[model samples]
Every structure is written in C-alpha cells, then in structure tokens.
Target: MFFEILKNLRKKFKRLYITMFKNYIIFVFLMLLVLSGTIGFMIFSIGKMVSSEDYIKDTQKFFMASKIVKSDYKKIDASKIVASKGWVEILNSNKKVIYVIGTKKDKVTSYTENELLNFMDLSYNNLKSGTSYFYSVTAFNSNGEDLYCIVKVPPGIVTLNVDIAPSPDKYIKKAAIYILVGIFIIIVFLTVSVFLYAYLTTKKVVMPLKKILQGIKRMTEEDYSTRINFNAENKFGEIRDAFNFMAEKIEASIFERNRMENLKQQLLSDISHDLKTPLTSIMGYSKALNDGVVENDKKIKQYLNIIYNKSKRTVSLIENLHEFTKLDNSKFLISKEECDFCEFVREIVSEYYNEFEEKNFELEINLPEDEIIYEFDKVEMERAISNIISNILKYNEVGTKAKIELTYDNSKIQLIIADDGVGIDESLKENIFEPFVRGDKSRYTKGGTGLGLSIANKIVQKHGGTLTLEKCKKYKTVFRLKL
Candidate 1:
C-alpha cells in the first residue's frame, strides 16, 4: 500500500513539470524515504536490545524499597510507596514478619530462620510459574537492629536503587531528547544534500537548453550566422548538431535561389535584345520596299534578300528558345537506339556541305573506315552535331581548317570538332555552355542564336555523354565529346 502511494506520487509529479523538475522531485522523495527508514530501523533495534535483557536490573529499585519500609515508612507517604507499584515486608532476625505495607498479609510473611534462607528462592520459582515479576531482599541498616525484608516490585517505573545515587527519570528524558535532536540533525543534513544535488543537476540541463533556445530564436529571425556551441557527448549534443546542419542547408538554399533569380532577369534582357535587332531590320527593309525606296530590280532584289535573312534569324532565335526550354524540363523524353555514329555525323556534315562551300570554309572528316555503332537518340544527336557545325561556320574565318574526328575504343567513344578561327574569349570560357552566352557581346556580330553550344551540351549529357572545350593540338579551338 505504501509503495502504491509512492508510485502514484511519482506519476503525478512527473506530469507536473519538465525533466529537471522530475529529477528534483524523485531525488527528494528518495532521500526522505532513506531518512525515514534509517530512523525507524534504529529505534526498532534499540527497543529489541532493551527487551532482550532479563529483569535483574530491577534489583536495585527493589533494594531501595526495602530501606524505605525498614526505617522510613512512618515518615514516607504510604500512597507514594504504592505509586511505586511495590509492597514491603520487614522480618526480625528470627525470620518472623514485624510489619507489612502496601500488600495483604500472606503465609510467606513468617518463617523459621532456615526457611527464611530458602524463602526467596522458592518465591521466585513460584512467581516464574505464574506471571513474571521482579523482587529483591536485603538486610536493612537502621537503628543498630538486625532486620531483613523482601520487596516485591511490580513493572511500572522502578526507581533505581544503585549506590552513590541514581536518577532514572532524568536519564530517560535526556535520552529521548537526544534521539529527537539526532533525527532533526539528520533531516537537515539530508535536505541540504538533496537540494545541492538537485541544483547542480538541473543547472547542467538548463544551461544547454538555454543555449539551444537562443539559437532557435535567432534562426526564427532569419539569422543563420550563429551556431549551437555545445560539446557534450549526449542527446542534447545530437540535437544541437542536427539543428546546425538544418540551418546551414537553409542558408545555402536561399543563396542559390537569389542567384537563380538574378540569372533569370539577365536571360530575359538578353532574349529581348536578340529579338529586337532582327525585327528592326526586317521592319525597316519592308518599309523601304513598300515605300518604293528601291527604284530598280537590283536594289529591290537586295532588299528582299536582306528581309528574308532577317526573318530567318528571328525564326532561328524562337526555335532555339523553344528547344532549350524543352530540354531543361525534367519530364522531356528522348528516343534511343543503336545507330552508326560516324554515319550520323557524315550525313550532318553533308547537309552543311553547300553552306561550307558558300562560306569558303574547309571541312576535314576523320573516321574509322568501318561503321562505329553506339546507342543514342538519333534526331537529338543529329541536332547537336548540326549545332556544333553551325557554330563553326558562324564564328570561324573563311578558309579556316575545320576538322571532325571520331575516335573509339572498347569502352567509350570520343568525337572532336576543331576550327582555326579566333578562339572563345578567355573571360567567357568558364561559362561558354551557359544559355544564350556568346563570345561576341553584340547580337549582330554573328548572325545566330547563342544557344547552340548550351543546347548541344544538354543533349549530349541526356545521352549519357559529356561535351567540353579543350586546348587543340593543331587547331585554334576544339570541342570534345565523350560517351
């Protein structure tokens, strides 16, 4: 029943507060239980010790009672003797009773001298056979008379009859006071110890929790600079580390998001700039022809050619934008199959043969005589190769050496395109594959959209291949493709 109440208290106290409070309550309760048990066990042990001894220690009290009856009964109150719960009997030297006090007259009061010698022994045996009692007999020294008496003392408070004086009441009261004081001292010491332990333990917990709460508050205010600086090897330490990691990730994500937003604004400006140049030229040329500004067949033909070219540039820009958008979408799908890569590039270069001749640019092709088969999306790969070739035509000087080389081993394939024209600007090399990035800043410098390299790189990557620019051994610039 006691344990059940303690268990209920533990549950109630636990729900009352935080973990630190729970520890404090449990520690105090345990200390109190230990103190109670210690005091209870000690008091019980003292009682057992006092009871284990025989009643022979009461002999001194009985001797004092015999003295009172022998010489001082007339001076002492009979009620006081009865209050001591003992009766007195005096016998003459002949062993006959002279007087009896505080008890009825009995047969053992008178005896022969020999009988008196054995009287106490027989009386004790009889008393043992009935109920337990304590008695004493001694020669009383009073008035120079030889007298003997027996005092039968009952079991209330027996006054000690020891020589040199004894005070039973004083000792008992002092012992009881000392026991109470000792218990109080122990309780005070235990209370102090319990509170000290609770204070130290709760401080350990609250200090770390305070630091963590401060960090979280900073994080809530969008301040990710501060860190939780806990070094303990415990669960709180794990919480601190995890919190730091989350804050770091959130900071990085915000930085990246801002960067992308700036890039998006820049892309819009570039697109508008590119489209406006062609549209302006087309509008001006058409207006001239409509207004009869070209008066002859030759001027009219030249104006028509200019208008057609401007229209074509505008169409190319829109197409490139659409293609890039599609490729950037993660859901965009491409069809793949095994095809002859060398033949595929050969066909693409053949389509550009007329343009190469018109521009007076040289075309060099290198391939193994046998067909080199590879898995790829045929239409996408052809578009990528055409974009590479188109970039060479648009950027390279006329009559520059333009070479296409295909090399393969057991595991992979490499395709190289080189041109002996002005290489990419050193400043733009790092971001050459970025969307709408071109060597020449002016949209009219080269009559093409700048998305060629960017779109080509994306297509090659989608086919589990990479496209990168590298230093050429025999050419001004080279673009290498590895699959």
Candidate 2:
C-alpha cells in the first residue's frame, strides 16, 4: 500500500479525482502506520514492565536469602546483600527483628502484628517514615521453630506490587479482552475518519464534473449557448476554461451555418426571378410572331428583333450564373503569372475609351510610367476590372466623371476606379458584393445579372488580393483593388 501510494504521487495526471483519491490513500496509510506503531509500543512496554528479567532475578534472590536465613543465618553474606542495594531481616514468631544484614537505613527493629500484616499487604505505604521500600516475605522452619524472613529492596532497585490470590487466570483473561476491544475501537475510529476524509475531498471534484456534464447535456439538446462556471483550482479550472472555449466555437459555427443557409435561399430566389423575366419576354414575342399577330412588315421585323434581344439577355444571365457558381467552388484554382499591371489597366481602359466618348462621359486616366509587375491570372483579372467599369457606365449619367488610377509601392500595388455617379444606396453598401444584390430596384430594366461585383470580388480573392468599395472624399463610388 505504501509503495502504491508513493508511485501514484510520482506521476502527473490531469484528473482531479484520481489525485485526491491517491492523497487520501496515502493519508490513511500513514495514519495506520502511526496507530500500529503506538499499539506495538504500548504492548512492548507493558510486557517489559511486567515480566522483565530484572524483576524475576530479584524474586529469586529474595527466595535464596530466605532459605539461607532459615538453615544458617551466619552463612548469609551481608556484602552480597549490600551490593544488591537491599537488606535482610530475620524476624521471630513475635514479629521482632532477631537479625539484620547489609546497610540498613530504617531504625525500626520491632513491629506489631498489625504493622507486620500492613507491610506484607500489596498496597503497603511507608508514609510516616517518609521513605519507601519493596518488601518480600518468606515463612520457613528453623530448628523446628517458625520464623519470618523479610527482604527489603529500595524503590529505586526493584518495585513490584502484586496481589496474592489463589488463581490469576481470570484477571489475565479480562485484561486480554479489554486490550482487544480497545484496539478494535481505535481501528474503527480511524477507518471512519479515513472514509470521511475521502468523501469530503472527492465531493469537491464530483461537483465540478456534474456541472460540466450538465452543460454537455444541454449542448446535445441543441442549446449552443450553454456554458459552465467552475471557480476551482488546477485541473478543474482548466477544464472550465476549455469547456467554455469549445462552447463559444460551437455557437459561432452554428450561427455562421445559419447565415450561409439564408444566403443560399436568397440566391436561389434571385436567380429564379431574373431568369423568368427574360424568358417570359422571349416566349411571348415568339408566340406573337408565329401566330401572325403583327401584320405590318416593319412591325414584324421589330418584334423579331425584340425576341432575339430577350433570348440573348436570358443566355447572358445563364452564363453569369455559371461563372458565379464556378468561382464559388472551393476546388477552383486560378492560373497566376507575372504581368505588367500598369499596361494591363491601360489596355482595358482603352477598350472602354470609345464607349465613354459616345456616352459623353468625362474620363480621368492616371497610370504610372514604370512597369508594376504582379502575379495574377490575366483573363480573370480583366473580367473583374471590366465588370466594375461596365457598372459605372450603365448606372451613371452622361456627364458623370469616371476615373481610373493605378498606384504602387515597393510592397504592394493598388488600383482605384472611381466615378461621381448615382452612389450606391446606403442600405445595400454592406452587402454590395453578395450575389444577386443590385443598386437598381427595377430588376428587368437594369440590364444587369447582379453577379458582376460578387464575381469580381471572388476573382480578386482567388488572386490573393482584395477588392473593396472604400469610402472616398472625392468620388461618390470608389473601388480599390490591392495586390
């Protein structure tokens, strides 16, 4: 048990209950060791005091002195008696001391019958003389006469006071039973103490565990907000922190999942509405032409052109939806290469320069002379930039000032496209880059699929860059692309 308890102490475990239990075991073991040592010491002391060799040898010496005094008192040596730190007195039947041997300190030479009996009694006390001695008396026959021989030993030499009885077996048996009962009571008391300590110590650990379990049960019931508070120490404190952190992460994950689900539903609804409007126009125009509803040749040509335009718009919407879906795919990879960003912007702007002139819109172009080379997919990057430029032309008035500026430093390149056009609605600014989110309320008349900004944002993200609609003091709408 000692080895097992010590071994557990040597290891470092994260569990609180195990550690507490080990400590309790160690405490009980130590208490038992101490109790056992105390009991053993008490038994050893009692046995040594009761039946020691010194006590037995002293009794034998007194018996030998009695025999020698009865047979031949002169042969009993006084030197031997004095050396043993005691004296001998030979008393006649009249209770009078007839002979004395060794160094005697007492002056009493005669004793009354009552005094003699008192001296021989087990509870003998020499209070009047202010000195105490142990007396052993032996009655024997000398020359056919009765004589009492008393051996007096000082208290410092040997002290034994035992009651004379016919049989001492019953007393011994009673003493043994009392000792056994005392030991049993002590063992029971110590056992109860150990268990109480174990329960109290383990209770501290169990309470915290119960609290954590309750939190887990609540979470399993879809209560993501459930949390636990444990104002404990060591492993329990750490467990509390870990559990709370896990709960926060789970709650956040659930919230994000719900948000993405809502966005998916909104995207589906917008797709359906945009597709149905263009298809309805195409179907109606074709039906009118096939049924000969228009008689004039000019009207027939106009109706055919309208049907053709509506079909083209429907096809464009489908193609934009396809591009958005492809870009949103997690497995999609962009082919990146080193390209001159300054020249790339200039070329894209030159393509739209004629359109700007035809629309009578003011244009501002700012491009650095030195080449700013960056890694990006040229085709994808062109599509993203063209989407922003096309949106500016589609929404702004004829006299709206359009600006394209490219700037760079040693670390990064920034391209800014700004226009003083009808600014985006405040309500839509936050979600402007979400799919199917449009600035124009009239979906049919806007001539846009509303996936332009979202696709552009995704493309820039794929190239490890950012495209953000930032606040600007000079322009109403500013799109900043950083690489």
Candidate 3:
C-alpha cells in the first residue's frame, strides 16, 4: 500500500521529479569527488609528515636508548646517546652528574634532589644556555647499582614521552595500504551510484521523446488527426498542447477542402443537366420544322414559338450562370449610393404589382412612412429583391398571398419577403441558398435554372448585407434581408 501511494505521487509530479533528481545526482557526484580528493590529500600530507627522515630517525634513536637503559645502564654508549645538536647525561643515586657527552652548556655538575626531580618531571627551558630541551629519563639497576640516564634533545630535533614503532618504514607501508583500500571502496560505490542515476534520468527523458516522435511520424503519413497526449509540467506540456492545436486546424482544413471539391463536382453535374434539357428541346423542334413534319400553318407557328421559347430559356440559364460567376469573382465591387430605402422598396414592389395582378396573386406591402435612408447599389439591390418575388410567384398557386415588409433602425435595415404557399422542402432548408439546390423534383419540370436564390445571396453579400431564409409564424416561407 505504501509503495502504491509513492508511485502515484511520482507519476503526478514526474517532470519535477526528473529535474530535481538530475540535479541531485550531479550534486552527489561532485561531493563525492571533492570528498575523495580531500581524503587523499589529508592522507598524503600525514604520510609526508610522519615518514620524514628526521622524525623517523628521532623515533628510532629514542627507542634504542630506552632498550639499552632498561637492560644495562653501564652498556650505554655516549657517542650514540646525543642527537646532532643535543646532549646526554648520567647521574648517580646521589643526584649528581657523573658522566656527560656532547655539548653540555649547563654549568651545574652537582644537583639537589629537588633540582634533579624537576629535570625529570618537566621539559626544562634553561635560561643560561638559552636552549629548550625535551627530556626522557630511564632508571635502571646494574648489579644492584642505581643510576639514571637522561636523553635530552632540542625541541626541534626530536619528540619525547610518546610511544612509536621501531620500524618507521613498515608502519608507513601498512598505513598506506589501508588508505588505498578505503579510497578504492569509495570510488567503486560512487561509480555504481552514478551509473544508476544516469540510467534512471535517461529513461525519464527518452520515454516522452519517443511518444512525440511517434506522433510526428503518424502526421507525416498524412494522419492530420494525430495528437500527442503528454502530461508534464515542463516544456513537454507546452509541446503537447501546441501539437493538438495544430492537428485540429489541419483536420478542419482537410475537411473543408474535401467539401469544396465535392461541391464543385455537383455544380458541374447540375449545370450540364439544366443546359442539356433546353438545348435538346430546341434541337427537336427545329429539326421537326426542317424535316417538314408539321404541315398546318398554325401548328408550324406553334412549333416555331416552342423553339424560340426553349432557346430563350437556355440563354437565360447561361446569363444567370454568368452573373453568378461574376459575383463570385474576388475583384467584383458594387457601386453604392445613398437613397431612401423605403421609396426604393416601394418602386420595386410597384413594378411587380402588374405581374401579381395578372397572376391573380394576393399582394401585401408594409413600408414605413418615414424615409429610411441607406447606401446600396440600386441595380444589384433591385435584382436581389426581384429574384425573391419571382421565386415566390414561380412556386406558388395563383391565389397565394405574397407580402413585403421593410423595417430599419439606426444600425441596420431589414427587408422581409413572405408568402402563404407550398413551403420549401425540409431537406433543402439547410442549403437553400447554395447554387443548384431546388425545392423538389418538380423544380426541374417547372423550368428553373436553380440559381435565383444563390444569385440573390451573392448580390446581398457583395453589398455587405446578409440574405437568409427564416421561420415566421404567419407565413409558410420567409426570406429576410439585412443591410
């Protein structure tokens, strides 16, 4: 259970953990290097100090003198007793110096018991001689005779009153071996620790990098939907978010390109179908006249009229197609002029009044009394409005009611054209403004180019306005134009 909790915590803060762990490993390695160097330096310095010839010789001399005094004081050699600038003295049981060697600067040859005891008890600084000496005293019995041998050396030459090994070379070799072993152990431990640390840190970094590389590879294979799901608190997190955003944008772009390609193909198919129907009719009627198939004068005239009407319809379809293409051009611009929109709408309605009357269609006009002034291209705006009214007349019965309403505010003007007739098919509602989309199969039979609403929409858009089909409570079909 405890291990599971730790694992969860590690996963949650993996980035921070990796960063800190890397730093810790570096710190530990440096500290180990410094520690090892320090230990080696200290050991080397101590060995240099203890293994010096002067110090080793001093220890050897002291130990030799001690052995001689303990075995037999009479066997002491005066020449071997003193160091280079030091001296030796032998005193009888009466506390009087009986023998002396080397440079004895002190004048006192006889001593009181107290003076003798002082010399043996302390390292004495003799003022008259102006020399400081370290003293070592060895008391011995030679054939029941009591004697004291004092080995004195200047403080700089030797050390006294401390235990030392007799063979300095052997002692130094042993100590060096121990130090080398310790250093070797430390180096091995640090080496193992460093390898472990490097392995763990590399794993942490490489795993995320591998995931990113895989995502990039998939994207290279044309998978625009590829995305990375890296969870981290560092630069990797930013990379993940950027990758996902780019993928989303690329996916949307590809989808839009495909949709436009499909629409282009559909447009070509619709155009060919609409053009061929009329062309075929005109050819049939003309061929009949050329072959003399209709002999009656009236019938011949009717056939000629049919041919002319079919040819006119084909020309109209071609003209509508050209107008739509012109509006779609990027460089197309509309000439705008300030005019009374209310009056303008009334004028457009009046032109359609005679047609509506001839068709016996009910017409309702609701125009504001106030003059709503606006800037627009008069020719283009008129054509857009006429297209809507014409569409209403083309698809509705003779007694159908048609209404035009105009409203405006300080910011915008809205024009609505509505009719009580057969409403648009539900399936066509979404793309009603798209080119070549018609109400139903009856549209092809009714002789429409299917570009009326599309042309109107483009014209309105070119004038910086919007044309949309909207729902209304009182009308079955409603077209709203906002400028």
Candidate 4:
C-alpha cells in the first residue's frame, strides 16, 4: 500500500512537471490573474468600504450641525437662516433654522429629492427636540456665498432642479475599467513569466536530456567511447550512472571475448606446425617402405619401424591436442581423488614394458615406497604424464636409458624426467615446451610431433603447477614438474 501511494505520488508529480513543461504560459497567466485580483481588491475596493459609508457620514454631519444650533440659539426666526444661501445648506451653530439639502458640484441635484427630504427630516428630529421650527434650505456656491429660497423644509422636497448630461453610470463603468486594467497587468506579467520559465526549464532539463540522446545516437552507431557525463543531481544523475555502468560492462565483455578468439587462433597455428612436420616425415618413411628398393631386410625393417613410429607419433599428437582443446574450452571437468603419485607413475611406466623391450629403451625409475598421496584427476594426469614419456621415447634413440625420478620435499610433489641422449640444443631449450616447437633439430624427424610437451606443459599449469625444461645440454635434458 505504501508503495502504491508512492507510485501515485510520483505519477502526480510527473504530470505536474509535464504540465509545467507544455502549457507553462497558460499556467503563468492564471497565476498572474489571481495575483491581480488580490491587488485590485487591495487598491480600489477594500478600504473604500469604510470611507464613504454609503452617504451615512453626510447624514450624520447634518444631524450634528443641527444639534449644535439647538443648544446655542435663543428664540429667533428659524426661516431666515434657511433663506440666507441660494442652494447651499449652512451647517452653523448660531443659525436660526436647521435644515438639510443635497447638492453635487455646488448646485442642487433634483434626483431622489423626496428621499433626500425624508432623510433631512429624520436628521432634524435627532436635533429639534420638538421646538417650534420651520426648516429652510438654500443652494450655494462651493464657498457658500449665495442665498436661494425659503420654504417649508418638509414640503419643498421636490422644488430643486438639476441640469446635466447623462452621468455615464460611473460606478458600473469604473468597475469595468478596473477589470480591464487588471487583465492588462496580468497579461504583461504572465507573458514575461512564461517566457522566462520556459527558457530556463528547457535550458536546464530538456537540453541536457537532448545531449544524452545525442550520445546514445553516437553509441548506437558503434561509438563505444561515447559518454554521458552530465553533472546533475536528480533524475539526470541517475541516467548518467546507468549509462556508465552499461558501457563499462560492454567494454569489458568485448575485450575478454576478443582475447579468447585471438587465443584460439594462436592454438590453431601451433597445431598446424606440429601436424605438418610429422606428416612430412611419415610420408618420407612410408614411401621408402612402399618402394622396397632396399638391398637388405635390415634396412627395410628399419624403414617399416620408422613408418609405424611416425604414424603413432602423429596420432598421439592429434589426441593430445584434442585433449588440450577440450580443457581450454572448459568442456572437461577434473575430479579430485587422492592417489599415490609415486605408485601411479611407477605403475604407468611399467605398463609400457613391452614397447621399451621392442625399442631397447631402458627406463630408469627412481621412487620411494612411502606412498605420496596427492589429489588429482586420474585419467587426465595419466595422459599428461604418459605424453611426457612418449616424448622421451620418440626423441631418445636406441639403448638410451630415460631417467624418471619422483620426489616430495617440503610439502610439495615433484617429478623429474630427463634423457641423456642428444638432449636438447642449448639455444632452443627455452622454447622446448612451446606448442609445436621441437628443441633439438638433430632429434627432428625422429617420429613424434612436438606438441606433446606443450600439452604436458598446459596440463601441469592447469593443476596449479609448472612444467619446465629446467636445464638442458647436448647430453642431458631435464624437465621438472612441481605440484
């Protein structure tokens, strides 16, 4: 429920903001109109209510003058005072008669004369106190210098005359003029306010968003570096942060993917190198065996043996390369089962006893009876170790004893495979484990692809270990595996 309320409030605020965006002029106009109304009431209407009191002040003034007369005057003719002025009424304390008259612009106005007389008599009653009195009225200049007439104050209510043009109904016209003036002021303020507000809002909000849109357009066109770096607080800041995060992720993903593709290409190049050399040697040997131009059984048997070995070497290279490919592609999952490392290597070497006999290759096995247990993937480790053995078997010629040593020291397992037959050339020792790089040119065309060591190197690396031809000379090549 709270979330709903917040959602509603957000929608409402957005609508208000959009309304401000779209019809700001109209809104400003309406605001100015309200302000003008307040100002108008203050200026022309509000205080005036107390000022005129609807002609009541005039009536009260008249009554006060008549009362002063009654208190001060002795017996005298009341009609003479009324006759002294022409059309004006004397508001005098020493006057003989008390009377009231109405005038405008120094001349008596005849409109509503009867109502005027009734009011005059009512004012006199508040003053006269039942004294014998006949009221008189006269019109006067604005200075009260002329006398007008003597008549019964109650009876002569309608005798006055007025000359005038139509008064223009000033009250209604004044109201209309005030209204028009108010509308004019409101229009001026509204127009200016709306124009300024529209300019500022567009400059601050709409223009920045446009810039962000332009950046997006650039990005859509494959400009990866396009950035929306707006320095803002509210909604615009949020937009910038979101875009930045997305861009960062995109760049990282692209970099990693490109790196992987390059690595795959490099792997293919290595495979070609290993396969081409072996197949070339195999072809030369197979042609020799097939031609059978040998003069003796001995040379022919040698040719056939070379062909068989070359074929085996090519097959082993391809298999090992495929295994490495699987590992590199994350298709293989290794298991962590404990095994006696010394026993494992010893037993594996023992399995190839017949091949050793046929090739007259002596195996020098050095191990301890104390079981060296280690955690590894069994089948994969076997392939890795066996590939190294295969490399030794292919490179070392007849009667060459291959040294196999396994030792554990200081909480680490180490395996050493060394061959004393034309080991590896000193200059090429460093690159011996690189894919398809055969170190000893003298040992070239012996019968094995060079990728064997590379696969072994990669597998050992995968096991959090290192395999290196640590040292090599003309007669000794030593490979050390530390796990």
Q: Candidate order by TM-score, highest to lowest?
A: 2, 3, 1, 4
* lDDT (Cα, 0-100) at 193 in candidate 2: 78
Q: Estimate each model's TM-score.
A: 0.52, 0.58, 0.56, 0.39
- For model 4, the run of ten residues with the poorest summed lDDT: 157-166
Question: What is the alpha-carbon lDDT of model 2 when measured against the actual structure?
Answer: 0.78
Displacement of residue 67 (Cα, Å) in model 4 is 99
TM-score of 4: 0.39
lDDT score for residue 351 of model 1 = 93
Per residue, candidate 3 scores C-alpha lDDT tens digits across 400-482 of 88889998887799999999898898889889988888877687878788899999999999988899897778898999999
After superposition, candidate 2 runs with Cα above 4 Å error = 1-210, 229-238
State the lDDT of candidate 1 residue by residue for 339-395, as single tens digits.
Answer: 898888778878998989998887788987778888899998888988888888887
Task: Write one digit per residue (lDDT tens) for candidate 2, span 1-483.
Answer: 323422432342345557777887898798878688768765775566447654444334442344345456656655645776888888888878998887777988887887767666644433233347666666776787788777776666543333211244554664576578658867887888778876765665777778877987897788989989967776667767767777798899989899889999998998898888878988898889899898899998998898888788889889888999999999999898998989999999999999999889889999999998888899999999999999999988888988999999877889899988888988999899999888767534869889999999999999889999876777999999988
- Candidates in order have lDDT scores of 0.73, 0.78, 0.77, 0.62
Q: Pick the candidate with the highest TM-score.
A: 2
- Tens digits of lDDT, candidate 4, 1-483: 323533644664486577655666676566867786757774666246335554333223222333223322232234432442322244332332233433212333232446335444553335343433334343332234332222333223212221112232444565566667766776787688768877877775787678767866776776767677766775556666766666666667778788668756876886777677768987887776678767688887887787777677778778767776777665556776898888898888888778777889777778888999999877878878888877777767889877788999988998988877766777777767766567677545564556677778777877889987765452377888999
lDDT of 3: 0.77
